[model samples]
Target: MKKLRFSAFLAALMLTTLTACSTTDSGRRTVGQYVDDAAITAGVKAAIVNEPTLKVSEIQVETYEGVVQLSGFVSSAANIATASTVARSVNGVKSVKNDIRLK
Candidate 1:
């Protein structure tokens, strides 16, 4: 019984350590920072979806250290601009990098 318990504890410890040292596409970020960035990305996507003129499904949002990047294809220049503006307006966004292309 004791050996089984020790093995379980050791496994948990290794998992925690691996998660703490994990690197994301934009490089290393603490777990808190990663969660924050995820929130920012979700917020941007929600804002885009709420815009009547924008196609939310066509826009991809990514956030790294508060910097939002908007990608994917849209209908026009206006849509690209709107996506950038919407991403920028989201709270915790440091800046927006719009790479949306016309479809």
Candidate 2:
């Protein structure tokens, strides 16, 4: 019975160690999944600010992992396309989902 208990304890210790050692890609203190989402959000916001045809006030940016979800009203289809293109150009952006409604 003592031997079985020791084995189980060792197994649990190994699992804990492995879990603690795992980390995200950035490797900056492993801020967890929220950090990745925040990075994408910041990237999208920066892209929108730099895009000539897309006004920052007219769009909302939400990010999950590296995928960006853009939703809002824009002046024209060209503006929407421009926004999506701009968002895609941002670093660390895995995908762009443009859900902007044309006004």
Candidate 3:
């Protein structure tokens, strides 16, 4: 009886630990993280559109664990700076790594 009780306790402890480490409702990303990523993407797109010098053919915005990665090709360096600025301005973006290249 004592052995069974110990096994059950160990199982419960393992279950609790696993649950604590599991990802939240947004599949791989938490609810708050998802919202932040969406906000960052929207802000970057808006900035690209508003900037007259930047002619972005394809804008790829990816967020991983609150870090936003901006990948695309633009006409000039100024466009890249503009995009980075746009991403930084959005709330919840921990950092922006600009991988944008000049076309």
Candidate 4:
């Protein structure tokens, strides 16, 4: 049991080291920047869900460096537009990319 525990600990240490050295394709982000992007993504999703006309179940939100990206299938062009508008209204979002498509 002690040997198995040591092996597991070693594996976890290696995994943590690899992840700590990894950089996202969009480029490297400081921990603070990553947190900001996460907040922006959450805010955009909240806005979409809050909008009565938007179907939150059909929308996806992603944010990087303060730019929010909305990509998913909506029932109409208006929903796509509304999603973009809502994302842009978020406080930390620097820009909005609407890639929503009509079904």
Candidate 5:
């Protein structure tokens, strides 16, 4: 019985810690939002990799609140346009900010 009580207390403490960490005074993201952004970033990267005209290694992807920001150097103007289109096609992307430049 004592061991069970200690275990319950530990669980409650951990839960409180996680909840507290999720709240911020600055405009920072919560834990769940961070996870969502990571998923969006991954989806954008995967989409870029699948595009035959775009080189996956040449692009960098980041996401915040469903907005994806893509930046890097590509071979041509068409590749830049293609990357933007591909990022926009992803499921969780609200909008895309394409900063890709021609190499």
Candidate 6:
């Protein structure tokens, strides 16, 4: 019973810590802007994934104030261009920074 109580306490503490961290003020991002950036990142990733020609796992998406940045490696120049195009197609993406390296 004591061990189970400790385990429950640990789980609650971890959950509190995670929730606090998620809401912490970060960089220059207000909490609302942070949420917007997260949405933009998700949107770009979805666009890239929906594109049949690109491998979504090889790309990383980040957004700040509607600007989407794409990083990571792709097998060809075509993939880089495709990623940029897909990112641009996402509704919330203001601009796309394609930094994908050719493998």
For each candidate, what TM-score against the reference? 0.74, 0.68, 0.60, 0.74, 0.81, 0.73
Write one digit per residue (lDDT tens) for candidate 6, span 1-103: 9999999999999998766556435446566678888988988888887899999999999888899989999999999998999999888889988899998
Worst 10 residues of 2 by lDDT: 25-34
- Candidate ranking under lDDT, highest first, comes to 5, 1, 4, 6, 2, 3
Residue pair clashes in candidate 6? none
Model 4 regions more than 4 Å off: 1-27
What are the lDDT figures for the candidates, one per model? 0.89, 0.85, 0.77, 0.87, 0.90, 0.87
> Residue 95, candidate 1: how far off, in angstroms?
0.6
Give the clashing pairs for model 5: none
Tens digit of lDDT per residue, candidate 4, span 23-72? 66556885567878999888888888899999888998999899888898
Model 6 residue 5 CA deviation (Å) reads: 33
In TM-score terms, candidate 3 sits at 0.60
Instruction: State the lDDT of candidate 5 residue by residue for 3-33, as single tens digits.
Output: 9999999999999888856844265878777
In every candidate, how many clashes are there?
0, 0, 0, 0, 0, 0
Give candidate 2's whole-model lDDT. Answer: 0.85
Instruction: Tell how far residue 47 is off in model 6, in angstroms.
Output: 1.0
Model 6 segments more than 4 A misplaced: 1-27
Best-fitting candidate, scored by lDDT: 5
lDDT of 1 by residue, 1-103 (tens): 9999999999999999989777765677877789899999999999998999998889888888999988899889988888888888889999999889998
Return the clash pairs for model 3, or none.
Answer: none
In candidate 1, list every pair of residues with a backbone clash.
none
For model 3, give the 10-residue run with minimal summed lDDT: 50-59
TM-score computed on alpha carbons, candidate 4: 0.74
TM-score of candidate 5 on Cα atoms, chains taken together: 0.81
